[model samples]
Target: MGSTPRRSPRRRWASLLGATALAVTAGGALACPAGAAGTNVDFATHCIPPAVAGIPPIDGTTTANVSVDNTSPKVGDTVTVTYTVVTAAAGNPTDLALPADIMTPTGKVTLGGAQTGAVTVAGPKKNTPVPGKGAFPSFSMTGTFTVTSPGAITLSPGDYNIHTSYILELDTPCTVITPPAPVSETVTATSGTPTNTRSISLSSASGNPGDSVTVSGSDFTPGATVTLAGRSGDTQTADTATATVNAQGTFSGALTVNEPTTTGIVAYEGSAWNADLGAGPATYVVNDTTPVPDGSQKLTATVKAGTLSMSQAGDAVALSAVDFGQGGAATGALRTVTVKDFRGGPAGWSLTGKVTDFTGPGAKIGAGKLSWTPVCVTEAGSPSTCAAGSAGIVGVSGATLASTPDGTLTGGEFTVDAGLSLDVPAFTPPGSYSGVLTLTLT
Candidate 1:
């Protein structure tokens, strides 16, 4: 009796039909939609939540958490709001939007009630998902919302809602939200005092004649004029500041100490403005003189007349005159002279010469003059010519001369004559005579 295989055939068929119906209801009900149960499309509502459009969050921020004062701000009172946004999904939302409202919790939002501007977002976007668990995209945003109001408006401190939303087109379910990553930044302007530190130096402390000294300094104004104190005698101003100093703060100027003395030069930062930088002192020296002659004096003498007589019967007879010319003198004093006969030409005949001195006391002779003497001579022969004799015979000597001023006579004259014969000899060689002339101060 195994329970009589016990089922009726109809009973077995009914049981099979009920089980098939239950399976069909369970599978077909969930499969009826575009996506199967527990699939990505099944949670589409979660992935694409209702968009909360409002003011945008700050860049690089994961969420929008801004602090705004709901006080009734005056017309000029600037009320700023800081907003932050962060991505919670593996990729950035294609179209993210933000919106804000300032009103009581129960008041309806009005477009004209608030002042707004388009939000600016900056950063890289992720178009594709990561390989494994997909990357949790992150970003930050910072924005300042200025309040435009004429009077005070009250608002209690609370979690003020800032609508933030984004879109996700990927088949896999993904969430789009601006996490609360709020940040605040305050900017202010203030003024105090400027800093000024100046210094000056001279490259060289001293210099020679025509030498230049350089002066250098720092913190100098552009187009500044420089002046050296006592060194003005040698310092020269530069034509331009750029020529003197480069952008690196180096300056150079030359000071010529032409004078033979220690001079000081003071450099001023600017001519128009008085700013004494420093001073440089320098010295210079001078030296120079004239030329003089080597040889002290020169002397020259000339014989003007002379001739030999043969008719007188014995030897030669001649008469001649001498002249002393110009001389150079330093003391401006007169010089004396004396003469003698070396060869007696005849009886009662003598050789003589005269001296004329032009250099006087305290007198300067730029060009000197000449002096001459009268002439007398005698004959020296067998029948010598006598002064007063029938056989008038004579003997004579040539002239001898000397000057008082040693080595000072430049030129002079001498004379010779025959006492009893006129034997004028022709063709005599030109005679040049020299003597040592002494020079004295008297």
Candidate 2:
């Protein structure tokens, strides 16, 4: 945001909230009375998204209201929290309205005190995506968190971001600008003892086959023999590991995972009977370690499609007429020819041109008398320039106008043009002569 940023309605006033607003106490920000089941906190947040595409840069403020279902939840209890936009981004009437379907908003809430982690909140899939200004959608997001430890659990409005498909590589940043004190609530809990839940964890989540994976468990009946069996898919392997639980209600030992059929998770678990006493299962990933030796096997495939061809810019071209006043030779340029090589590369291609004998009112001219100087040009995506054929009489044998090297060309388009010449016999009669020039591509 610039130093003199024009901010949103609710957000700009964050600095206005001072010690004169309320007596700073030990966090009693709830809309609920002094003692209530659930709690609510009111605050202001500001966001400034950089200019993206055609959307202008906008930094605005919005009021937020957050509430929780259980303020004094015991340890191990899951609590649901809801964060609502009390006031939409309708401030700053000058802001350009964004069209719909481009944005799907999602956000986060910061947690502190007893629990130290952020809660994920998902917003509506879409808002009013129509074109407008200063009227952002007012939405709410709900998330859950399991209470791990019991104490004064504090919740604060945190930063969030606007997600848009228009510029996926960039992110819109927001901030919690509640100036006075972060609007927060204090959670008073009853039990401090954490629940001893049956759970299993592995030291390494993934490894090659035969790698030793340490299986750890907690809260199992102390001193009981923990039988940790290894299973790949539905089949249990012969190798198994066991460890005696200490009086502290925990155990950890090594188990080797060696499944050869496929690359996937290999589960090492305690016996089902031990599951009744707080023993769970864990898994170790096996790498796809299958070796491919040289000269073992070869697979080949072929796609038979496409072609090599040429196209003329026009149907026909009329060369400049020459007067048979004691003639020797006459020359003109051929029409622009484009040759496309879509023949799946390799053996290269050839573009040849030839002409038929010209017939006039009194006599006929020999086809072998026509000659051409061909020039081949490289076009877009062409690997190399097509080689120009020699300048000589072409009607005697087809002229190799333009051709690529044996292993050089790999499917691209090239342009070609040729200078055509006619040798007029000195004693020939004066008349208008016409001939057909045919171009071929292979």
Candidate 3:
């Protein structure tokens, strides 16, 4: 399928009511006091789901309950915010089911009054299966929003987007309408203590090259431009991402890992000590991704494997001897050969065989007299293919026994078997003749 064209972001906040003021941020690691400050905000949200074929846009109210761990936080204190989507306005409205690995809800909450910054919240992915006729799953997102300074912070609902991407790109732009009050919640901050900017984190600790990561910074000067420098060990890499500090002194932006880069990052307000950041930066690990065999989703492993090889079962095969006095034909089963491909690459492999002339007591029989019927079988459930060689004499020129063509994976074990036969002539010299059979795999 071709790439899906992106639709312009829909503007829906203006028409909807106030959203449940939910603030989510990364805060636990920051130093904060044990506190008794809280806010419970409840409100309804109206959303317009993406338009798909044969399914009408779902129109309903999504109720949410939000809470902050500490409302009376001091300057530079980290407070936890939890937003529970009490229920979804609608279920999977499309005829098709949304796949399992789709990401979950992530939205922003706006603040007014004394505090004037926004908090970003995101939930986890890999949710349970939502059947074609099942209801949309309910979810809860929890994170921390850092308190930058002393003020009476008022929370309000902000414009947020949701994704369902199945037949078309899954997108739902939502707005908060008709809340109990204009402000869904409030957080009062006092000028208790001041802690300089010194904390930073990334939404994803690791990712593949060309993948993007979110950089978060707290306690920075409001409206200041924070420079995000990718760090390798103690040295800064060539790549850098930047984010502007909001009115509340918090910032977040995306950084693309163009190469296999180390984790550490330095977010600072340029050279001067405008903020305490860059004093000692924390690192973020972005490792390279490995391609799996047979289109598997095993991306976490970094494996360096060996090449293709072949082994045969049993020592040798002894065909029924021809007595010459009653000569007719000598036949037996060829030894079973196993081929293993571990080259990691998609280039396939081939197995061919040839045999030398039979020799007995200074007399010999032509290798052309030997012919075989070949058979091949791939291992059970293996995403590879093996083909039997043409039934004929395998002489010096050699013939293919089994092969997995190029452009396809030939991983795992595959067996190549053959039924061997030798045409014996009358009065032929046969004193337990033995010949070497050579099999080559590449």
Candidate 4:
């Protein structure tokens, strides 16, 4: 204009203005242009919201707390893990599709869903609704994870993030779960007592040799053995619970007291707990003896040349005699005798005859001859005169005796000497005789 303003090209004028602006903002961006220009080009940036965490609610009592052990999981080990989700911050819901993730990919991570050989993801709904205030959304899920790799995995100990955005389509953010607290429990055994008890006594304290004494005791076991000692007896085994104590306890038989003696018999019982009889042994005493004959003496008679004779003379001719002295003596005696017959037998011989008195020698009077005489003699000798010629005799006359096979007597007689004068003569027979005999006790 003043010199015609030196006219410039249009493209050259545009390039010059862009080069001047690049130089001014080379190291940094340019500040908004003054007032009206900045108002026309407004700019801003937005950030993703933080995820929330919460502990899952437990149904039952927490046993102590969840403790992480050094147990490496195997293929078929039954594993039960419990967890609690706690919300750190409150805003939008956290999608919990995959609650745990395998960082090293050593094993498959599973959640609350049906399982297969491959890795599984499970939990509450992805895009779970979260409240305005910080909320402890509780959840529990169980599944098994299998190790596909051989060695251990090197993983840092920290909260691992679960990518729920890939598994489920959701608008809410996802978060890592924290471990739970630790806990412990106890265990115990018991037993019962036993059941068991013992009975035994003597029936009688005194008994004879052949007497049976009962041993009364209860609960005697089968094949229980009982022994009775002290006396000359033997032991006894009970066939049943009850047994008879014989005189002797010897042998398997009854006890028998054979000999005559006074002894105490001890009964010993044996069982499982008790061995032999101790202080409480059952005892019994036995006593016995042979009986003695009364009012008799043992005697033996000798026959002279197969002949036996006896003479007696008294108020009544009598002889007292006895047999083997087992019973008493025989009491009456024969007066006189005449020979009827005579013989001998196995035991001895006796003579059978009749009794009569002689008035004189060889005197035959009445129906028969009086072959016997009676005599009476006293120490005082007071009666000095006889009936006719001599004094009376106080004893018996001659009597002969013999025996036969049937115990019959024959050819026996009572005889007197022709020259002998007597008042009443009494003759005593020797040895044992059971017939009868006279007695003269002055």
Candidate 4 error regions (>4 Å): 1-199, 218-223, 228-256, 269-281, 293-442
Better of 2 and 4 by lDDT: 2
Sliding window of 10 residues with minimal summed lDDT for model 4: 11-20
Give candidate 4's root-mean-square deviation (CA, Å).
Answer: 67.4
Q: Who wins the TM-score comparison?
A: 3
Q: Given candidate 1, what's the lDDT at residue 339?
A: 22
Q: Model 4, range 193-221, lDDT digits (tens) per residue? A: 21211123333433445666444433334
lDDT of 1: 0.24
lDDT of each: 0.24, 0.53, 0.57, 0.24
Q: What global local distance difference test value does model 3 have?
A: 0.57
At residue 143, candidate 4 shows an lDDT of 19
Task: By TM-score, rank the candidates, best first.
Answer: 3, 2, 1, 4
The prediction achieving the highest lDDT against the true structure is 3
Query: Least accurate stretch of 10 residues (summed lDDT) in model 1?
Result: 11-20
The CA lDDT at 319 in model 4 is 26
Pairwise TM-score winner, candidates 2 and 3: 3
lDDT of 2 at 359: 71
RMSD to native, candidate 2: 31.0
Residue lDDT tens for model 3, 1-442? 1232232221110000000111112112221211222232345566675665346555566655455545666776655454555456656765677766453465555657765555555444435678876766666444445566678887654444555433344556555666432454577888855556345655543444676878877667789888877766456777677789999877888877665655445678875333345422433444334344575554222333344556656554566766666666677776677777664333456677676676666676677777789999998865567889899987657788788753323366688888887776667764656565666554
For model 2, how does the per-residue alpha-carbon lDDT over 66-125 read when each residue is reduced to its tens digit?
A: 556446677754455556655544322224455554443445566787666555554433
- Off-target runs (Cα >4 Å) in candidate 3 are 1-46, 51-57, 99-101, 164-169, 177-185, 195-225, 229-239, 242-267, 271-275, 278-442
